[model samples]
Target: MTDRLPYWRLSGFYLFYFALLGATAPFFGLYFAHLGFSPERIGELLAIPMLMRCVAPNLWGWLGDVSGRRLAIVRFGALCTLLSFALIFVERSFAWLALVMALHAFFWHAVLPQFEVITLAHLREQAARYSQLRLWGSVGFILAVSGLGMLFERLGMQAWPWAIVAIMSGILLASLWVPNAQPEARSDRRARGGFIRQLRQPGVLAFFACVALMQLSHGPYYTFMSIHLEALGYGRGVIGLLWSLGVLAEILLFMVMSKVLARFSLRAILSASFVIAVVRWLLLGHLADELAILLLAQLMHAATFGAFHVASIHFIQRSFAAGQQGQGQALYATLSGIGGALGALYAGYSWTRLGPSWTFALASLAALVAAVIIATRLSEERA
Candidate 1:
């Protein structure tokens, strides 16, 4: 144990963290709707937390990077999550619910980007091991979705607040003991400047742009998929299992991500993921009546989310010079945050007017665009 890097312990951290997110993300919409909120209102309320992510991570990440107190920032974020979500019990009115959601989400969004830096720091040369560690997060998501879905089926949507509270508390506990992410060594001034300079390059900007669109396309799925399923008369527990099935597929991909990356180019993986994302959303759009196809669509989550995410991380690492790592990740978080917030906001508008099929078709188009952007423009790897 002493001789080996504690990658497994680090994986445990993500497992708990994302398990909490899985519980929080998919069910929160159903819970609010059960509280007598209308669709538009639910959209507004759901979007609040994501909107907070736009700035929360950038602010906290800058602090974490500059102060070199990454663990402290993570701990503070967790503590705020523990405190903020407690307001849910007191929040009865729509305005109060919005406030509580925003507060908790701000804190929640702060943790992951910094945590990625931590994980990367821990696994420097053996970073392929990241997939192995990250797969547990998918497992956690599966279990949370499957279990909470069942609990909701029997107990009603009111059970959500309790489930979320338990998961966040677990995240808080795990975060407390996990060590901070420390750069193995700081870069000298010249290296740092050159690294930051890459942000201005067309290739890097194009890459980040593609990533932003990819996350944007996920907004509808993130905010309204549960509502859509419920409206279609799917049982809460079954819906949960369906959500878990997607993450289970993601888990399978992550389990083998090391091998996949070894064999394929990042651009190839990313392009393929986007292509699958296009098909997946289309299936969700037109084939909503077909159970087997819907299941197949769910499984494509492995490529759409899992491979794309891993590719993004590796690309950022490869794209930026060493000194610029913290900033690079911060930028990625910033784009994802802003893109997600905007996507959800628009999806809300589309839900009533264009309906699910049109809404998802738009999402598929976004992925197709992302594929065009990456496949054509990504610069050849430097010698």
Candidate 2:
């Protein structure tokens, strides 16, 4: 198994999958705004896909576990994601956009968590190596954001859908090539029997709660940072550079993640991530026009996303037995979904009512609360 990692196949899937994310996440809201959607309406539109995350991963995970056909699910999900997104060219009405977002995301959200399990299965004992492969995702994101940022600068957001369609098509094709693999065995009968008992364990719920809150704080950034910068008078090309810069920070951190994981406890990493996130949000909210400060804040993506994600996934890998990995990953995605949906909905309302400054202040508060929860409730183990 170690000798047969299928490195390019797995990495290609991640590259193209996140490439699709790169095209959409940074520019999608801007496109919607160009089409005359208000902040609240755009928020509603963005939230639909996140709302799908609440159910899609678990449903697909169940199918994979029951049928032992994880790759089949990935291929099907990718194809459907492409098909649903292709409909965007036919209409731009708010209702049509909402339906498309939900339709595409239902399958899109399922691919990653299940693929994470497959990747970990392939890595077996060398779990730290997971970052090496996953970093290509950050690279893909950087390429998409930076390149498309420049393209959209000249051609306008009207070109956005075509870029996304091309990337989504790439994802569908890549999914067809990844070979299926199973996680290694474990002796926990509870995975097959008492699933509820696993949920009630020490730190599990607390960890998930913290993760949800962290993502909730990201609502404004994920949904509106591009628009936010544009409102601050930055060009789309610069906006793309800012977005790519954040992912670039994440990519660099991933390069060193194995060393960082070996040295620091997961508790330390998570706690620091939450704390830094609080500062990052505050800076983005109040100091966005200051290029130096904005750059500094974006670099904090290393802590906010890079460290937080690596730690959380490692924690999940350690906590769940082999048979339960699917459900565990699904729960993570679901909780993240719930947080993201609420965050987007709240940010939508808040951006109109509270304005960007206070809205981001609220986001900082969310991260602070998450940090406090982690400090007190979570253990200091080196997961």
Q: Which stretches of candidate 1 lie over 4 Å from their true place?
A: 186-195, 321-323
The clash count of every prediction, one per candidate, is 0, 0
Evaluate residue 99 in candidate 2 and report its C-alpha lDDT on the 0 to 100 scale: 85
- Which model scores highest in TM-score? 2
Stretches > 4 Å off in candidate 2: 189-193
Q: Evaluated with lDDT, which candidate comes out highest?
A: 2
Q: For residues 1-383, could you state the per-residue lDDT of candidate 2 as single tens digits?
A: 26688888888888998887789889989999999999999999988988998999889877776776777888888888889989998888888888899999999988898898998888888899888888888889999999999999899889998899899888888888888899877666546554457777778899999888998999999999999999999999999999999999999999999999989888889999999999999999999999999999999998999889888889988887787788888889998999999889999999989999998999999999999999888888823
Q: What is the lDDT of residue 116 in candidate 2?
A: 89
lDDT of 1 by residue, 273-318 (tens): 9899999989988886678998999999999999999988888776
